[model samples]
Target: MMGALGQSFINGITIGSSYALVAVGFTLIFGVLRVVYLSHAAVLAACAYIGYGVIEVTNSAVAAIVVATLAGAVLGVVIERIAIRPVRGQNHLIPMVTSISVAIIIEETLRLTVLSGQPISYPDTFASTVIRLHVGGAEPYFTVGQVLIFALTLALVLTLRVVVQRTWVGRAMRAVADSEDVSSLLGVRVNVTSARTMALASMLAGAAGVLLALSIGAIDAHFAEPLQFKALAIVLFAGLGSIPGAVVGGYLLGFVEAFAAGYLDTSYRDLFAYVLMIAILMMRPQGLFGRRLTQRV
Candidate 1:
């Protein structure tokens, strides 16, 4: 029993790391743009497919990752300029609706063009590699894919922390998040800052998408839908705009799902996340790290 539990814990952490990547991107976009950016899932899928294509040509995972990240960043800029910028500061519902429409368009386009609504297997880069770790009397193992996910996630998270805490663009992003109007008045280029934020967030999402495809060994057109919901739950669980909260919430959700699947029913794994989400919403709507705002007249 202890052996099984240890194995499950390892699996949970590996999966949770991927969720943390997606959730962090979700929170970053929300913090900067104040929009849900529902098309994030679509962007993820698109980048994954792009990565797959690059791998097919170059057979280099590194090249695929770089190309996909760039593609996602460019897509983010396009989405912002074409779909989001025009709707900025309008009724919040407008941007939300536009994002949904954009998501649908991206999904459908992928379905009709390259993906054909089918599952495409990723190249067998690390599928056969496994690291065996002996912990006590139990032997818990991790796949090379899982190890890469964990390492990349850690690196990305630390890089993001540095960017947010130590860079000029990061400062601009924080200022814009505080108040776009005030930031602009203070000579901050609000448009440029927003664009930079979107690029960074989308690049993260792209990396996540590629990692997910590598982990699962396949890319499916509809793969992003459930992930999108999971990411949303993580964001809400952590607090809408808190980066640290998103990471913690993501791991929490991943562990809950992993445990539920390993010990309970696999079919009910997704239920745990929604249940936790509801519990958090009811108990502390502001989220674990969220601060309640006091409006003044």
Candidate 2:
């Protein structure tokens, strides 16, 4: 029984770390730009496919990740330019609709081309190699890739914190987030800040895709779309635009899912976080880490 519990804990952390990565990306964009970015899942899926292609050609996961990160950053800029920037200052819903349109276009393009409208196996994820020291068991507690995911998530998220809190670019971003018009008038480059913010967020998004692809070992054109909702739930529950809260919520969701699947019906796992999210909203509308913002209509 103790062994089972320990294993479940491990499972939760592994799964949750990936969720945190995805949620952080979503939260950053919303926190900085106030854009829901409906096309995030499309970008993730596209980056995964791009990573897969790189793996096939170079037989190196590192190369795949690099290529996918660049691809994701570029895509983020493109979407910001086309779907977000043009719709800036318009009704928020308009940009959401435009983002959805961009998402649909990207998904369809991948479906017809690289994806071939079907699910495909992720090549050589290296899931079996144990990287941790043995703890008197034949098998190690965690695999190399899982450890890497955890370490990489920690590093990337910490780096994001430093970037946002310690850097001049981050200052511009926060200023824009506070008030774009004011920031622009104050000589802050609003466009550049927003573009840089999206690129940073998209890099995390792309990394999440590749990491999850490695864990799940399979990908379909639309598989990531459902996960986007999961990430969104984490973001909402953690707090609107609360990156750290989202990270914690991601791990919480992972634990919930791990235990739900372990001791209860598997189907209910997906519903658990959402139900909890609604409950949290009812009790604390500002979310676990979000502050209530007052705006004049």
Candidate 3:
């Protein structure tokens, strides 16, 4: 039982790292645009498929990953320029609805063309190597994929943190997030900042899609939906625009699901995210790191 529990804990951390990556990307878009871009889920799914095709053609995981990340970056700019930008001018809420429409369209396109609406086995070549881990009286094994996921998630997430907190682009993003008018006056190109933020966030999503595909061992048009919702839950749990908070929330949810599935049934795995989110909402609507508005009377 202890060994099983320990394994679950490890699994949770690995899964949580991916969750944090997705949540941070989701949060970044909200920070700049102040709107929830639901189409992000579609972008992530599409990138995973793109990666699959790349791997199929090149027979190289590295190529797949690179192509997927680049594809996501391009799609981010495209969506920002085409779909979101047009509706964004109308109202902040308008983009949310418009993005949903875009997401649906992308979903349908992928289903009809890619799957004809059926799930397929994900490539396991990336995760074929198995390494045995020595523990106290319990031999917990590790896979190349799991180790890769943890390492890449840590490195990428830390790199993102540094870029956000210590770079000119980070400053511009923070400035725009604070107030577009003020940022513009300060010589921070607001439009450019928004586009860059989208590209950066979407790239993370792209990387995450590959990691997710490697971990899950199967792919489908809508497989990313649950993960997307879980990412939203992490975003809310960490607060609306708190990138660090999202990271923490991602790992927390990951552990939660891991333990729950370890001791209980897999059927209840997805249910806990909504329950946890609801609990967080009831307990702290502002989130763990969210700032409350203090309006002057």
Candidate 2, 147-203: lDDT as tens digits: 667888998999999999999998998898899999999999988888898899889
lDDT of 3 by residue, 206-229 (tens): 888877887777888888888888
Query: In model 2, what lDDT does residue 19 have?
Result: 87
Candidate 3: which stretches are off by over 4 Å? none
RMSD of 2: 2.3
lDDT of 1 by residue, 156-213 (tens): 8879878987998899899988999999999999888878888888888888888888
Superposed Cα deviation of residue 5, candidate 3 (Å): 1.4
Which one wins by TM-score: 2 or 3?
3
Report lDDT per candidate: 0.85, 0.84, 0.84
Ranking by lDDT: 1, 2, 3
Clashes of each: 0, 0, 0
In model 1, where do residues sit more than 4 Å from their true spots? 134-139
How many backbone overlaps does candidate 1 show? 0
Error at 86, model 3, angstroms? 2.0
Q: Which pairs of residues collide in model 1?
A: none
lDDT at residue 105 of model 3 (Cα atoms)? 89
> Each model's TM-score?
0.94, 0.93, 0.94
